[model samples]
Target: MTVIVGASAAGLACAEALRRKGYTGPLTLVGAESHLPYDRPPLSKQVLSGDWEPARARLRSAEALSALDATLVLGDPAVHLDVPERAVHTASGRILKADNIVLATGLRPLTLAGQPTLRTVDDALTLRKRLLGCTNAVVVGDGVLGAEIAATARRMGVAVTLAGPQSAPMALQLGPRVASELASLHAAQGVSLRLGAAVTEVSEDGVLLETGEVLPADVVVVAFGSAPATDWLQDSGLTLGNGIVCDSRLRAAEGIYACGDVARWHHETLGRMVRLENRTNATEQGIAVAANILGADEAFLPVPYFWTDQFSAKIHVHGFVSPDATVVEGSASEGRFVVRYHRDGAVTGVLGWNMPKQARQHRAEISLRCPAGVAASTPGAA
Candidate 1:
């Protein structure tokens, strides 16, 4: 028997992969939320913007999940883990014991009081309802989620103010040049930029900044970042820090493994332990963990990739971005281009602004270069 915790993208992927790889053992998937596993990327864009229904974001239909032949335990949050017995204790007083266990609990959003944070489909729907009634919104954090929320709100005809410590949105992930261009795009799209300041507090009126300025808004969104959901494993005898510490195989202990946003495993190529809290990594890492569980004994090394759509811009990135970048193809001035980032005379990243195809074609170069800095994606709210 195998028990998978999370029922998220990663957990669903792992369960499907296990079955695809010919595992016929009894399987169970547990989720904290009552809703079925859904794709999170759309929560901030399509779902929130009313372009896509919440049900459309579901990863699989009821019939498809039924075909997998796995028992699903929903709305029962795991409270504790007994490592020795390989058992999971849930909030609903159900104790599931399994021979193999996969931890895919994902993340917990960092939020401020009286603010909405997008993580689940329900959260997206709730925020969407508020957005409809709001005339002004202030989004805290300049990361991927924050930028996305601000863009969505602005498109809905609500005035948006984006506040963060970075000089430009996604500066930490996209580096300086591309991020600055992104700033220009946001400003042109009618989303006010309040960069280079930390959000000191959140009130009924608006968000207070460290610079003693208050950005007034009717709706506030906190999308700064997230931490791994490993609180249930603290006393479970598993090594926990940034996430569940795992080896190259993602094994937390004997008969147990961790994957997705909650797992921080050693990267063979980078020669360092890393944790990525992004949608792509969650699915890919889950598949990789499934392979390792079946005795593939392979090291999981992947070129991180992520895409963001705001207004007329669709940015696709492969690998890590550095400030020093050279336009390899297209033209940045025309808002359509592919740029290669360099660090210490080697290529570290590739980005495409409205040219996804060209950017993907250059993805091969990342493997050839294979610098110490693997293009780990910037963590999202999920």
Candidate 2:
């Protein structure tokens, strides 16, 4: 018997993979939320923009999940994990014993002391309602989520003001040069960019900056970041540092595995541990964990990749680029370039803004261990 702790991308994919790999064991999935497993990446985009309803985001219908022969215990949180007995205790006082367990609890958005965040479907719906009625929105944090919200607000004809400590938008991920260009793009779209600023307080009507300036707003959104949803596993004896620590196989403990944004798995290629909060990593890692759990001798080695759609631009990232890495290809001004991060003549990572085909090729070539020279091509020309 196998018990999955989450019903999101990682948990759902893990269950499907187990069935596909011929695991005829009794499978049970436990989810805290009432809604079925749904695609979260679009919650901040399409769902927030009213283009798609929450029901349409589900990856599997109730009937489809039933066809997989997996019992779903929804609307109840997994409150306890008895590692010695191999059982999970739920909020509803149900003790589910399993031969193996997969923890795919995913993550919760980091909310400010009082401000709201856009993480779950309910959060998006609330935000959408507020955004539709509000005239000005004050967004805290300049990361991907913050930027996306700001972009969407501007598209809806709402005035947006982005406040963050980063020198430019997404600076922590895309480096200063590319982040500067993104900041300029946002500014050109009529969104106010308050870089290098911190929010001292979030009020009912506005955000008070550290500089003692109160920015009037109808809604305040906090998009700072997220931490792993591993608080419930603190006493589970799992090797948890920033998240539930897992090996390359995504196994955190004996008969128990973790993946998605909640697992800090070791990357063999990078020779270090990385916890990626992206859909690609989540699905691939989930499948890999399932294969290994089913006694397949497959090793999970995936190139870290992510994509973001902001306004009219779609940015793709392959590999992790350091700040000091040479800007191998592409210019920041054009907003369509490939930035490669290298160390000692070997390609380590790549970031492609507004370049999908190049990013896809980069991910494929790097996964196959392509030569450095060949992988370092200009955007769109690859």
Best by lDDT: 1
lDDT of 1 by residue, 239-325 (tens): 998899998889999989998989988877777777886888899989988898888989888777888998889999988876688
Per-residue C-alpha lDDT of model 2 across residues 13-111, encoded as one tens digit per residue = 999999998999899999999988899989888899888988999998878988999999999999889888889999999999999999999887778
lDDT of each: 0.88, 0.80
TM per candidate: 0.97, 0.92
lDDT of 1: 0.88
Best by TM-score: 1
Clashes of each: 2, 0
Candidate 2, poorest ten consecutive residues by summed lDDT: 373-382
**Could you tell me the TM-score of candidate 2?**
0.92
Instruction: Write down the lDDT that model 2 would get.
Output: 0.80
